[model samples]
Target: MPIKQSGKRLRVPWRKKLDENGLPLTLPTYMAYCAVAGALRPWNRLGAKTIVTLVTTDDFYFPLFAEAARYFSSQIWHPQRYHGNVLQCSDKNFRHEAEALRDERAILFASPSYQIQEDDRLLSDAVVSLGPRSARHAEAALRRAGLPITNESVELLLTEPWSRLSRAFQDRRDALQAIQRLRSLPKAIPPAASEAESPPSTPDPTLSDMHGFGSSLIEWGYDLAKDIADYKAGIIPWRDVENGVLISGPPGVGKTMFARVLANTCKVPIIYGSASRWQEAGALDEHLKAMRASFDESREKAPSILFIDEIDVFGNRGETDRHSAYMRAVITALLQLLDGFERRKGVVVLGACNYPDLLDSAIKRPGRLDRHIAVPLPDAAARRSILKRHSGVTLCSADYEVFDMATEGMSGADIERLVRDARRAARRQSERLNSLHILDNLRPLVKLPSAYVHSLAVHEAGHALVSHEVGYANVADIKISRWRVEGEYRALGCVEYDVGADRPRTRTFFENAIAVCLAGIAAEIEVFGSFSQGAAGDDAADLNRATELATAMVGAFGMGHTLAVEKFSPNAFARMRSSNPELRREIHNVLETELERAKSIIRLQRAAHQALVTRLVDVDQISGAEVAEIIRNHRRPTVSLAKPERRAAR
Candidate 1:
């Protein structure tokens, strides 16, 4: 296959090579095969001309080479003829065996990376670097081979390579058991940590850990948890409790989380299933067998939760689509075992799907997955609650209440990501987790229109120009983006500060930080006679940051009216400042001082400011070095970068 990358056509040479008969079956096998094949093209010619030997860095590629040799065992080395020593790993133990084969006019794969001097003779034939083991190369091979991979499992296979992947699966051909293990895990945790001497296993997730769920759905889940508890305790028969529920929601609303939590609450095991799991087996009979095995496992593990994700992928039988015949057969088999002659006894069925409308009508009939609940994206209140739930001590209720207004239309997934990203940013900064980190780390949702995009350029250009004027920090770069936050699309701007490690966190240092933060609004006042809410509209915006810095300067650093360190708490500070006019005046004076300083700088450097803004309006991004150069030279930016429409908008 020819893949076009960066204007070049690259050929991907891949064949199944050898993933059969007790050999590991995985993507790595194919990737390893690709590297070897690409290194030695025209397989037969290489075998005929010289004694082909692959000298490797790691012995991990031994099986890979053996499989390749077995596949291309042709001519004097015909596939059926050259059996065992077609490819021998020339390791320390097998050195004699490999040399013996070498003498007999056979190919011997050597370990030149280990001891090049000892195996110097083997390297003369051809020394090729094994580097085609890239996920991109392997994925192309997988697609051509028609190997089925789940959307979720693809990340685990590709992102976490070698150790985790090889441990999970060795090859894809005849890897039914490996596929089965991956299919059951709703969240695929890379299994590499188990062998690395980690801490003791923690307890499972319970009901309390789950949040942002609809009241009815959560209440139903809890009651079911209790009933399952009773059923397992022998206080009631399995038929007394509702047998199943169908939880439908958009992706990342935690559909599978419900089952895991409920199982934890009731102290029963949970087994995961999905249409893809059954469909992993290509043939109809094998698909049926896999489906039956999942059901049978649930039946034997009585009082267990059987959670089937992406249930809608089974598709509907009524529609006369091309795939109807096979699906109808699978659905019929599923329906029979779901409530068939052999009762499921104490199993609780929970079916999860992104689109409930796509599910088979029979799957949700009474006595099956009957109860249906729809989980929608969290609104303002729910988003606030979700933020608090995920943040732990990183943020408080008052902090969340402020953010609640800011994160109006975010989903449960988005909120979790917000907290996770904040933690990562905080770790990188070597600081304690703070609400500002969470707020600042939010990703841009969408690109903007022409009008707001121009304004963002002006706002960011101001910060970049003013930060350079201030000696506390230097502007690394400035960018404006069309940010789609909530349902609304608006322009947002950012200025990265390069604060040197040599700078001390003294009162002057913080005061400089405050001035840099205030530069945005100051520049706006200078250029447009007024600034937009882009400065201080939300709790996490520039105005808020400036205020926080000034507040910390006064109270935390003992720089203003009170020369006492008031340990910072965002909520407490907000409340204290609101109540105490004296403290408020102190913060206001500090802000006003920085504002006037920035405006004065803007007035003097108006040409540089306008030049940078014009360039930014054109390019949407500018480097700090170039920005400084522009300011230094006071040169007009080239008018070529902006579109005609953007120039008109400006």
Candidate 2:
């Protein structure tokens, strides 16, 4: 029967190369067989005046040689065969038979198992055999075949001696043709409009000239910049070199851009791909093609980096049969390629995702994803940096306070938008920009009411107070607005808290949890004598998170000293979002207990709370400076008598 032939295969065990019998069969194996067949072409085409023996000592290689001979005879040119012209001799008799045929012109293909010596009678016309081991074997074989070569060039010779030369010639010819075609092309038509008739001209010096990062929270972004710099310096040794990294953060946090910057800093060619592009059925296959193309492109330009943005879309944790099978195939192909890292040099893989937990476990394992970096919201320092970078304003003082209170929970993108809106407002106001214009533009940032603002303030302040008082969270800033602007989201208050550098540690402090959650509502009740829905969302989230943590501590972790019950249930958030009668009753019970505890704490600091609220209501927008002044003048020392003394700390 004719030898079956198709695409290339390799005997890579990891890739399921061999059959159940452990026989030699794979794309690489087939390709190698074809390679040998081509190598025998010179002799096959010469019409065989003398016997040329192709011998393989390794049993694994017998099938490969036989296939090669058969393929060559059927697919390529065939030579006249004498009685022993095309012989597959055993290793024991390979040397003796070759010596007997020394007088005749012939080709001998034998494994490295047969050593080559200068005095060996048949050395002149012998070509050494090679298995799927080292390229050096091919080099030695070529040398024995009277074509001395190096390992570097052996791949080309063994794979395609004539094809390589042909490819180079074709490339040169195509390049010349392209240049000639370009030269022959017609010139572009000039703009016929006169200067007066043309649209107003504006000089664009740089692509980024008009496209700045905008009023970003530069101070908050300082740490991010440092992290980026550290990344550039390769300071953070990736925990797993084999597995790619997962970068998760809020939207518009420059995740993709960060990948690009890292790639550029490393001076590596980026194979930038997106999961969105591969969402369709056959899209992943096309992506694989592009990936292969990128490798080729990288070969021409080494040190390649493949940046996959929104990687979760491709590697989502789901059954393999669900979604596109092509996607799974693509992932499998990528895994195969990744596993080939030992053979593939200078290729780095980077994957970015906002929902990293949604990624498949197989993709995230060591030697696959290995690294998971949480690019969280920008801190105060980072916010300031982002603002400085994006904002065009050059404040008189380096310690300007506009960003200190304006930005809290805002992401880098949010800060940038604030800057952009401010700039646009300034431009519309006709002429030189001032800080007031920016402030005015930022006034209606959150589209909320005064009642909401007051409620949020109380809520956020509550969080800050309890967090600080309980000694779990360090207070950074508390404001009832967008992190990028003061008096921003009137209904939405944000309290910036530093949970400290001790990570992989539980964040929720049980002592502070209930009080922190009830602070907003308490403040609202204190001022308005009634509660508003302003702090509803935040309260629910915080309460749910705290309760879940506490429950987990009691149940899953067995950390609770008293309640050692292991409560296993999927409805963790059932107590939070549910409005069912029984659930609401349970929630109220839970909340009231916490609220009473919070009330007791606040009662102890009633005077301080009253003074702070009064100051906030009067000021409308209070700086950290003003807060400090108020705290110094009105805050009492007795409220903190129960707490420990301050110590030297970061």
Candidates in order have lDDT scores of: 0.68, 0.50
Can you write out model 2's per-residue Cα lDDT over 1-650, one digit (the tens) per residue? 89753322322122332333333233323344445654554454322434344544332344444433444433222322222223344332555556436535433455546554444434335453432323543444444333446543454333332222223323225433432343454432223213322346743222132122233322223333344445546775433133256667778777766665555544555677666664432555567776666555644553456677887876642555666576677667666665555433445667788788777777777766566777767766666667666665654442344454555667778877877777655433322346665566543333346665555566565555555555544455555442334344323445656655763333134435556766666665665776665544543465545555444444445443443343466364454335335434544555676666666656566665666566555544455455445555655565452234334358
Worst 10 residues of 2 by lDDT: 204-213
Cα distance off (Å), candidate 1, residue 229: 2.3
Candidate 2 displacement at residue 221 in angstroms: 15
Instruction: Return the TM-score for each candidate structure.
Output: 0.40, 0.49
How large is the C-alpha RMSD of every model relative to the true structure? 21.4, 30.5
Tens-digit lDDT track for model 1 on 490-543? 335677878678866766677667777878888888878999866776777888
Query: With candidate 1 superimposed using the best TM-score fit, by how many Å does residue 288's alpha carbon deviate from the native?
Result: 0.9
